[model samples]
Target chain A: MSSTWLAEAFAVFGKDWRSEMRARHSVATLVLFALTTLIIASLALGPIGASPGERSEVVAALLWILLLFAAAAGLPRAFVHEEESRTAAALRLAARPSAVFAGKLLWVASLLAALEAIATPLAVALFDLEVASPLGLLAALAGGGLGLAAATTVLAAIVAQGRGATTLFAALAFPLLVPLAVLAVAATRSALLGGEAGPVLLQLLLYDGSIVVAGFLLFPVIWNP
Target chain B: MRATSLSFSGVSRRFGRVAVLRGAAGEVAAGGLLAVRGPNGSGKSTLLRCLAGLLAIERGEIRAREEGRELATADRRRRIGFLAPDLALYEELSVAENVELFARLRGVAPEPGLAIARRFALPAGRPWGALSSGMRQRLRWAWALLHAPRLLLLDEPFQNLDAEGEATARALLDEHLASGGLAVAASPVSLPLPRITGELDLAR
Candidate 1:
């Protein structure tokens, strides 16, 4: 990208970051949802009474699902807030659609990464899980976080334009994100079980790239329309 | 650089089965003002939006030119400043921050916007949501003039303003036209402009 485009994108990102800092709506919602879900899951499961192999699998699956649902609950606010506040038209006139998309994508990715940083260790401690490959775990989380951000950011923009936005976002996001979730679960499980996570990591990487490219390509149409 | 001018003819737009604007036409040369006068729900806002390239017209042509060269839609949009009741800045941001944000997005220095805000006597540190309605209208003017756009598309330019605020707005519009800038204002009452190049009266 050209320096001007990057500068404009960063301007948008900074604006969103500052706005979110003051409002704290999405952050509060995401944190509360994630924490509540984690608490409920831990209480209900109460230490997985299964084989070590099955325990890791269950923990991995549960962790990804929790993160995915939390993302669904909060990320749509990125664009929905703009529409609700009547700022979308001013933003549309001020910046290019691609720049706006990139900025929102960055904000969503940053939020997801931060959520993972906090929740991953918390989940590990709560579940009493051991990581066999820290590098593999990190890779899976990083790739998965970026892919999830890419998919949700564009979908949020699409959802903001229509009615029943919250319900629409969940309906649109879960089906699209299932593959990424599966890859993330498998990679996490492999990392936890000392298995080779190379193939799953590669697949996750491909998924990240494909979804990001698709998001960039599709966002302009969705944003302008 | 030659002065910019705008012309539109046979413009028509619809929302579902209802036609909002039908066969609306007008033109304004540089250093002139075109007043769009009409009653409520007369599609004055729709026509201004169409001229700003914000909404697509069903069947019509709108063109902006500078130096005898027709400007493309993107080029026109870049040089056009638009303001309406529905358009809003970030409420959480302070006045200075909002001005700076739009300046950076428009790729211009923030100094000009800051200066404009100061000229309007706006509190730089005040949050947008905390501002009164009149103050908000002044801030909108400051934003619209931030980039020194060639074409100004203003809808209800005098809304929610006291006499002093209205005078400030009038002075700004007068200054803009005197500097060879073009303007199209949609208002229910007559504008205080000294010279109106043309008027498109939309009937309800």
Candidate 2:
């Protein structure tokens, strides 16, 4: 990337971080949503200590579901807030579209990271979950977070222009995220059960890379309208 | 800064089945301000947005020139500063932070606004949301001129201001025109700027 591209993106990122720090609305909502779902799941599955295989399968699916819903609830704010407050026009006038996309991607990714940090530990503690391969689990989380942010940022822009954007964000993001969600669950299950994670991790990396590239290429057209 | 010019020919824009601007055209060379007048919903703001590249035209071309030289269409946005009612600052950010962000994003030095801030009685450390309407308008004006832009597109440039604020704004526009900058403004009444040399009456 060019220097101007990077500089402009970082400027956007800094602006977003400053704003989010003061508001603290979106991050709080995401973390609360994830934890609420995790608590509900834990209460429903009370005292049922199944075999390792059974536990990993159920826990993996539960974790991914919570993350999916949490992302849908919060990530759309990145674009929706801009359009609602009329800051989108100012940004369009100041920075290139690609730079805006990059900056938004960074902001969303950081949100995902913060959500995972708090949610993952809470899930493990509440559900009595165990990860046999810590390194593999970390890699999976990083890949999944990147994929989620990349896909959601662009999709958020798409729905931001329409009415009922919050409800529409989930409807639109679910289909686009099916592949990533599936691979993330598989990789998490493997790491939780001491299975080799190389193949699933590779697949997750490929899926994440593809979507990030696609989002970068397509966001300019999506943003202009 | 270099002198700038803007010209549009046979320009038209539509929203759904309704035409907002139809075959409307005008030009403002450097050192001139073109005041656009129209009734409510008469496409004055739409015309300004089309020139700003925030809205694309359906049936014509908008072009820019710098120092008497024509420029490419893609290069026009970077050379223009636009202020509109819908153009907003980050409410969560302090006044200085907003100015800094806009400057860095445009790859220009942040305009030092302590004097201007004092003139407007604006608090630099306050969040934008905390400011009154007049103060916010003044902030917007300060940033639009931040980069010493070659062309300025202002929609309702005097939306919410008192007599003193309007006087300050008129003087700023006067200095901008004196320095060979191009400006286009949308208003229902006459703008106080004395250098307005042409008018585009969209109400007709």
Candidate 3:
């Protein structure tokens, strides 16, 4: 039973990957938006020499803002594309609801990871951001990215059902993401200043866990409706 | 394979205050073809979706049983193949790739979509987006039949088909019925299949 679940989810994941590989539209849009935002914000900020602490806090906040908004823009593609293309019905009939949710969540998480790989380096290099604990910063980014994907993928499924889903996605995503963004930013700031980020990291992990559980439980209700 | 049966009783659905399907009911046993005919907004598609378990029925039970044993919801989904007018394949994928994906999702080895594609003269190497309306309709049939489901539910199954494509679809439906597979189809126009033994007209 578990094997079939895993196999079905993998099938969905592969299908999404192959389709995305052909189009690359969503990835291009996301990466471009993240790069453009980082460049514009860094240039606009000029050189902020106000102590390393203040600089770290501001830069960390800026990074989360960029990543969060980028996620809000792109993650909806996982479910929204299915809804728009009218393929969701075919999928619903073909795979289990939980399998579909798992597959979509995996796809969104992968996209988040890729976006971070590109955006993090650009943000660091362009902003001249200093991180005392690079490893801790990476951990925070991973946790934050997971949390962001978990929270938004379910919401994406919800909004995908409505007309004007794209616009509704933006309006619905921001409020739901506040808790994730706050913990992520705090952890990122702590990581940059070489402070103990373990507490915030733990909090982010818990948040990620809770949201993923919630998403799995709630997705069938949202999906089948 | 045991003879399959899809039975529904007093199935009703609503969108807000507007009831799309009220007290709609029917049954299609194996080797039987049931045509669901109605005008627009009569909930033909809604009935098909409810039977396929894609939509929740507000007040009804849709059961797919075999040899007197009821199939679970998940099992019923596996045994059923669904096609709708608006149902689409991956536009980025080739004809063969799209069919292969659906086959794999059904936990089956990819069969020859080539024969089906050739029957409709579908360009096997072309992306779905590049296919014409008739070709897309043909491919939808190919995808639907790849798994050889026990219960086939189709909505507006004859749309965008030329005479040849329509003939191909008819032949496919006939073959499914011959193999003791039950089929329920929704169409605005009459689909005169010799094998059709029952029908649910929503106009009432």
Candidate 4:
């Protein structure tokens, strides 16, 4: 990332993350949701004696589904700071739209990262599943969570200025997110089943890069007046 | 380039087969106040949106002088002050907070105008869009003016103003022009006050 890239990303993300810290809703809500989800997964997939591969598959899928919703839960106000206050218009007026996109991705990345930290450990503990390479789970999480944040934030901004923002957000996001869901689940399954992560991590990086480029091109088109 | 001016050359815009504006062209120069005259459905607002970069142009170019070079779209927007009828205000924030947000977004310093003293002060406590028209109008003007924009575009600026309100509105325009700026106002009819440099009859 260029220096301006980080600068702009931090500036935009700083606004929401600060509020989220003060509001405590993003962390508090996702953590509680993850906890309840873990309990449910624990009970439903009970006994820990099931075949490790089966446990790994189900755990991977369940873990992802929970994290996906947690990430989506925070998507509503993605670019809402700009929408709600005319600040968005000012943001357009003030800086390049590329800067705004970078900043927003940063915010969404951090939010998703926080949620990942909360969910990943609980996922392993609750499911009685083995983490093949602790490092693999870490890589899957750091890569996957940020990818989810970056992609979701762009979609959120697209919906932020619309008439039925939240409803439309989910609808627009679902189709675009199929690829991400596949990649995240695959990576996690590999992690839990003790497979090599180099390839999976490469896929995750490609996913992130594609989104970063797509977002860079499309955001200014959608974000501005 | 001049200090402030907006010109649309053969500017035409359409959505599918629905033409909002065509062959629409005009000029408003620095210290020149122009009023765009048109009735409903005449594309007055659409024209301003094009100037503000909120709407894209279809056929022609919009040129606003920028540091001795003619710039278009977002470049024009950076120097122009735009006030749309459908005002977008951040409601969750306080009055001063909203203003400060815009000011900071423009990378400018803060200026607090008394959050304590009650009457006739900046509308600090009220939620955005939750105030009287005059107050909302004041906030709109403040947001656009926060960056000391060179070109100001007002759409139906006097929409809900009464006799006294109209007087105040004209005074604000006069004050703005006194400082070597440009203003293009779109309205239904002419007001009695002075300082209009030109008129674009969009009704034709």
Candidate 5:
């Protein structure tokens, strides 16, 4: 990207971050939802009670599900709030469509990364997850978080234009995110089990890249239309 | 540098099964103003939005030109400043931050925006949500002119303004026109403009 484009995108990102800091909409929702879900999962599963094999398998799937649903709870607010407050038109006029997308993507990615930073360690401790490859786990979370953010950012823009936005966001996002969820769960499982996680990590990275490219390609139409 | 001009013809727009604007045509040369007069729900805002490239027309063409060269969509958007009732800045942000955000996005210096804010007597530290309606309207004017756009599209420009705010808006509009900036303003009532090059009555 050109320097001007990068500057514009960063401006957008900075604006969103500042606004979010004041509003605390996505952050509050994401943290509350993730924490509540984690508590319920810990209570239901009763920490480390499951066999070693089942612990990795169940915790891996549950962790991704928790993260995905928690992200959904908050991320849609990024675009939906703009429409609700009627600020989208001003933003649309002021910034390029791609820059807006990149900015929102950055904001969403940062939110997810923060969520992972908190939720992942808690999950590992709560579930007694055996992390055989710390690097592999980090890679999985980073790649998976980015992919989730990319998908949610564009989908949020699409959902913002229509009614029943929350329902619509979940309905659309779940189906599209299932593949990412599957890949994330597999990667986490492999990492926990000390298995070869390189292939799965690569797949997650490819998925993140694809979603980001597609988001850039499709956001203009979704944003402007 | 020659001034920019905007012209549109055979424009038609619809929402679902209902048509809003049909065959709407008007032109505003550089240093000219075009008033769009209509009743509520008469598609005055719709037409201005179409001209601003915020809304797409089902038929006809809207063209913006500079120095006799037709500008593309991106160029037109960049050169156009738009304000409407539904358009808003971030409520959580202070006036300075809002202006700075838009200035950066438009790739302009924030000093001009700050100057405009000062002219409007807006409190630099006041959050948008805390501002009164009149204050909000003044801030909107500051934002619209901050980028020094060549073309201005305003919908109901005088809606929430008190006499002082209205005068400020009128002065800004006049200054913009005097600088060879093209403007299209939509209002249900009579506009305060001193001179109108043409008018498009969308109610008809």
Candidate 6:
């Protein structure tokens, strides 16, 4: 009955949220992990009033690196929900792959958004960093999270098939993520150091937009295969 | 609509020149059970997979019903239910949960699924990995049946069935076939269908 892509995505996202509530695994673990990473980042970076670009670069790279791992951990758990249940076939039987991808993409996006929201404050607290413009940082996260979530979900699906897919996850991820990683680090630095955030963010937007489109187009192939 | 169908013209499949189904031509009747029997590597499973659209046929055309016409490879695939030995069920989930999850994927009605679960006596609390072979067989059977697929392409539906279990399984297949559903089963057992309408003997 859900005809539109957005509706189907909502349906898939709803399923994950409800399941997460029952399992109490995804949200809790992601938050804990993100906070712990923030602690390590603060200790490592120290109190440096470096250029805005430097701060943003470190933060963006570290954040996405963590998300890459988090997605690796979580996306498999998501698809395995269908596989171990022998429900992948069942799903193919009923719904189109576009719908499946929509649902899964939305679920990943929401989980990413929540983790970012939680990690932001924790990062600020642990690192003793000041956001030059709080609203800009939040906006950057909104776009970055959506793009990262979509790309990671698709990448994880292919990687999950490989043995000990955790290593495979990181191995396959770093290359595809280079553009976004650079843009994010740069954008964040600009935002934090009171410079023109525009050019850096435009690059980030391009990276994010391309990945989101790619994930959107190719997700169904993985869902059915 | 005469249901969805499949056809192969000189359809020969080879795995790196190891031919399994060599020009094996057979048409599975809609609303009927077709049993495929073969020795090890005799290609029974491969044949079933090919029909199910899992394994691609190497040198043949596969026609599936698309838009009420036999279009020789379209989306009639959705109408087929396939189960293989290596096919896995979720380890952490209980039987009822696993089945319910598949139902969610298939978008089948929940009540009838629960009814089937009840018939199999599948424990609501029993995880899939912990179940006995017979129990697992029953559970897979239920998974295949829940969607009411037009064709059930099974590898060995009777492998672990006890006499009673076999009878129950046969009865389920029988009832489904009786209601004009099709079942293409691959097994060594001589299933008592209506005089073996279509059979592929690969025990060569």
Per-residue alpha-carbon lDDT of candidate 4 for residues A42-110, written as tens digits (9 for 90 to 100): 887686567878988987788778878876776656676467655565566555678778877887787
Q: Ten residues in a row with the worst lDDT in model 6 chain B?
A: B65-74
Candidate 4 has a DockQ of 0.24
What digit string (tens of lDDT, one per residue) describes model 1 on residues B1-204? Answer: 345899999999999999999999999998998999999888999998888777779999998987577887766666688988878889999899999898888888888778878877899999999998888888999889989887899999989988888888888888898988889999888777755899889974
Query: Would you estimate the TM-scores of all the predictions?
Result: 0.96, 0.95, 0.93, 0.82, 0.96, 0.82
List where candidate 4 sits over 4 angstroms from the true fold: A1-11, A18-36, A47-54, A70-90, A129-132, A157-176, B1-3, B112-120, B123-133, B160-169, B192-194
> Tens digit of lDDT per residue, candidate 5, span B41-157?
899988988887778889999889876778877667766888787778999999999998888888888998889889889999999999998889889989999988878999888
Top-down DockQ ranking: 5, 2, 3, 1, 6, 4
Instruction: Name model 3 segments beyond 4 Å from true.
Output: A1-3, A163-175, B112-115
Error of 4 at A92 (Å): 3.2
Give the DockQ-based CAPRI class for model 1. Answer: medium
What tens digits encode model 1's per-residue C-alpha lDDT throughout A1-225? 022778889998998888889989788888887778777876777754666666677778887897888888888888999999998878887888888999999999999988888778877776777889989989989989999999989889999989999888878887889999999999999988889899999999999999889888988788763
What digit string (tens of lDDT, one per residue) describes model 3 on residues B80-153?
A: 77878788888999998887777777777666556777777888789999999888899988877877777898
Off by over 4 Å in 2: A1-3, B1-3, B72-74, B113-115
Write one digit per residue (lDDT tens) for candidate 5, span A1-42. Answer: 023888889998898888888988778888888778877887
Q: DockQ score for model 6, please?
A: 0.25
The C-alpha RMSD in Å for every predicted model, in order, reads: 2.0, 2.2, 2.3, 4.2, 1.9, 3.8
Clashing pairs in 6: A9-A102, A52-A189, A56-A185, A56-A189, A57-A185, A84-B89, A84-B90, B63-B72
lDDT of 2: 0.84
Q: Write the per-residue lDDT of candidate 3 for residues A15-126, one digit (tens) a residue.
A: 8988898999588998899888888877777664456677677779988898888877777888888978888878887777898989988988888899889988887787
lDDT of 3: 0.84
Proportion of the native interface contacts kept in model 2: 0.62
- Tens digits of per-residue lDDT, candidate 4, B1-204, equal 474677877778887799989888888777888888888888889888888887778889787874456776766766677776666655555577666555555555436222211222545767664777666666666666666677888888877656665665677677778887788888777655457888888889
lDDT of 5: 0.86
How well does each candidate reproduce the native contacts, as fnat? 0.49, 0.62, 0.62, 0.26, 0.62, 0.20
